[model samples]
Target: MAWYHSYFKGLPQVAWKLHQDEEYTDFEVDFLRDVLELKKGNQVLDILSGYGRHALPLAEAGCKMTCIDISAEYCDELSNAKTKRKLPVEVLCGDVLETDFGQGKFDAAYCLGNSLSFFPRADMLRFFTKIAGSVKPGGHVALHTENLAESILPNFQARNWMPVGDDIYYLAENEYRPEEGCIEAQQTFISGSEKVTHTVYQYIYTLAEISAMLESVGLKVVGTFGNLEADPFVLGDEQLYLVAVRK
Candidate 1:
């Protein structure tokens, strides 16, 4: 898994070709700007903030941003971006699972793009413990995860890839094994004249499981939406977006 290990090491250019799509970025930005209700003067922490794609813009909007990541490469890249834009952002290289931060440090916290899928239950518990300790009392945390009830992966052969920019492409091809609760996929990217690929294995979680995780960390699931727009969720049509309040 050295390739997976290198995920934070500057994104291998192929990742940009694979994932830096307008649809993908637009979807995320809409959520951050609209669903998360990002505003000026708010202090926020982004767990697993990838390459400052989300944090940098928030900084530009007059918020102080703290980004923690598992990749040193990404930390450095974020630092470089901070210097370029002079954004008020602090980038830390550490395991999101157990990063130590003082209580009430942030006005809000967020984890997006199904990053938790990379961890199993115990590890997710550790991350939540730290996050619960990181946010201020009554602060909020937004978590974005796939709504498996709406996923359309009916068969393994229903795989496809779409290009992003001139180089990157994203592949969402896989099948969910109900009993196993995992979606298996081959994600491929051709970046900067190099080919990068990964066999991505992810566990699917129900809305109930997501709520349970939040409750376990002393957070309450106040809202659950079907998409980034906070629409009434049609369980069989799309992913789940959640907003939880800290107690």
Candidate 2:
């Protein structure tokens, strides 16, 4: 299996452990709703939905959600959450690159948390194309990730450690390979004397490159932001948040 496949296969537990802040979750969900213009009963497709952080909130907000993840474990967890909460969510376990989203089946779709740039350029383009095929004409697409600007910055910190709670912390190490148009990271999670590590191979996409790919897939750029707060994307911004409309 590829590094990402192996890494994410069992990542639901660790990822959930680190991202349990309800306040931030609410804020992000609100941001997504605004970015996608989510309406009650609107059909939404969430690619790489993981344990359904965003999908659950969207579902609760009245959108019909189809959440997909590469990890069966995560998808099962999402399925349980849907049942427990009685939310309108469909959970599927499959590779996003290979999954079929029926033509014009959704009103909007999104791939957030740096999920868009995981594959090589060609594959990434195909992914966008597939996403376009799933959404109706003029539907929305939102993408959130750290942009190439920060990755190529001179003062970029390649390694960092952060505590999620009293007994849990994560160490992340990044290696930028511009020639290969990717950044590699090894993430180590330490929780109560137990340590788990995962490797991520992310292909870096510049704003222009990503824009072109979306356009090629018939998704036109509509808005750009630096964060969930909706600040305009500019140099030195912490990350990239783009909103596009299917054309």
Candidate 3:
């Protein structure tokens, strides 16, 4: 099984919850709304939508949301939240690569939270093609990642440690392989008496490569930003947020 198949369970999930900031989510959602020109009742797809952070809010705002996630734990949480809030959210648990996203079904689609790095070159192309075919003509697609080659290379760190919450401590040891154009990370999560370690892999793509791949899938690049505020992207900006339109 892939490392990502089991990476989101246990302490990692707790760490993610603790690390998330509501204010940041608000900023990101607003950016997405503007970039996608989303309106009430528009159908939206949230790729790898972990726990529906963006989906729930968009659904509450009157947009129809379809969220696909690989983790059943996250899908359950999202489903419970949808039930409690009575939101227009449909949560599907499965590998996004294999999931059938019908053609021309959605008005807009987004993959955020740095999830684009999960796939290698071929899989990335496949995912982009799926997304392009899933959205209507003139529809928009948005993506976010911090693993771009220009962003990570200049400031790469071999190891780092940080605290996620009062109880959870996290450490990451990263190894960059130029040949593979990927980062292999061994992450350790600790919370009180419990501890776990997992190996994570993220592919590194340059901006040119990513834009070309999106274009190859009939998604034309429109905007590239460094943050939710819509600043123009530059090298070593720590994040890449892209907006594309389906041709």
Q: For candidate 1, list the clashing residue pairs, or say none.
A: 14-191, 17-167, 17-168, 17-169, 18-168, 18-169, 147-239
| TM of each candidate vs. truth | 0.81, 0.91, 0.98
What is the Cα-based TM-score of model 2? 0.91
TM-score of 1: 0.81
Candidate 3 lDDT over 158-219, as tens digits, reads 99999998999999999999999999999999988899999999999999999999999899
lDDT of 2 at 17: 39
**Candidate maximizing TM-score:** 3
Per-prediction count of colliding residue pairs? 7, 0, 0
Sort by TM-score, top down from the best: 3, 2, 1
Q: Which stretches of candidate 1 lie above 4 Å from their native place? A: 1-4, 8-13, 16-18, 21-39, 147-149, 152-158, 168-179, 191-193
After superposing candidate 3 on the true structure, give the runs of residues whose Cα lies further than 4 Å from its correct spot. Answer: none
List of clashing residue pairs for candidate 2? none
Better of 1 and 3 by TM-score: 3
